[model samples]
Target: MNRRLSFSLILAAALSACARQPQLDDPVARGQRDFQGLGCIKCHQIGGEGHAWGPDLTLVGFRKQPAWLDLWLKNPHAWNAKTIMPNFNLRDDTRADLVAYLSAQKGQAWTVYPWRTAQAKALPSVERGKLIFNMAGCVACHGQDGFGGYPNNNVVGGLIPSLTNVSDGYGRADLHAKIQYGQISSPADPSKPKPLIYMPKWGDQLKPDEIDAVGDYLFSLKPKPAPGSAAASDDF
Candidate 1:
């Protein structure tokens, strides 16, 4: 009788242990658990579900590569010191799982997403560009009106370049080419890891006219110099 009781107890404990263990085989499932349990929803919104305190992550998969996402999740401050995002000190496996989950969020759930807005197409070129800049997540890195000061890992000056002075260096054609082809920032230290942030190619995502409109919006951001100043004369 005692042997049977011992066996029953062992069986019960085994079952309890199995119940407590999460499904470790599926990273995406584990990631979803982490997303909720870790309070990521408090700051970021996905598919208009969470709070809007941070940049909307509905299309993060489309904008960011998996490697970049993994690194960012592991240590946000390492990439951007001034970022409001707190580092959770996540384990390697946990960070990978979260990256998998976030990477799956490519904005397909929304029937009327920002990039497909018909109203934007009808607006003036400059106005449409402004809308696209914000909606396409340019504001996240470049800052509002392209007055950029965002930090990037191993990047020169440790911050993304501001677009306010782009016209000084790049003509309309050059600007268009940069936007369409995208740019990979060279690391400040060639020995160190590359910068986490890069310009994603918009050519595949945005129409030709939309790209032109974005150029117009960016050109408009150039600051007007005071009259008779050398900068003013240079602009002429």
Candidate 2:
């Protein structure tokens, strides 16, 4: 009886393994698998899945040249001297498959975060800020912690600012302006031109109070020193 049960378990495991196997004939499927394996999902979004630290690659094929992409993927620093993108050290075959997968991505709307509607009010918790950051789709560029230095795939020569220590200088009003209007850049400087406005205007998307909640959340990201730490002293 024990032997029969063991055989049944073995058969189930074998079937499961077969079911998990990807289709080898499909280049798209192979490419998707390779993309995930290379940890591209850590900072990129394809078809509304994965992280949003980089540009939405859903329409990458439409925006970027395949040749440019091949070179960019191999070494991002070659194109942008200050780009934070890292080389994956991928082999030729893997890079080819990954590029094929990225090139197949076409115009698709970003996935609406599940908790967007639920986050209408500002809750006084850093944890809530973290949730709104992701649910509001802020994590795609600013990251889950509000630190935003990730290389953008769509905007080749744009600047992405970090929000981790924003509260150190900017007051709540400044935060309100920046968050609701995407006003990080100075309008006085024509050379800057308000920084290409990569971030969407939260004023249109969220209510004033809701925007305030997000602002509060962003302002709270300053690291608190441990008890008895010298940095914790109020005096300089």
TM-score versus the correct structure, for each prediction: 0.76, 0.45
User: What TM-score would you give candidate 2 relative to the actual structure?
Assistant: 0.45
User: Best candidate per TM-score, number?
Assistant: 1
lDDT of 1 by residue, 74-97 (tens): 888877777889989999989999
- Global lDDT scores for all candidate models: 0.84, 0.66
How much is the lDDT of residue 112 in candidate 2?
Answer: 48
Q: What is the lDDT of residue 145 in candidate 2?
A: 82
lDDT for position 96 in model 1: 90
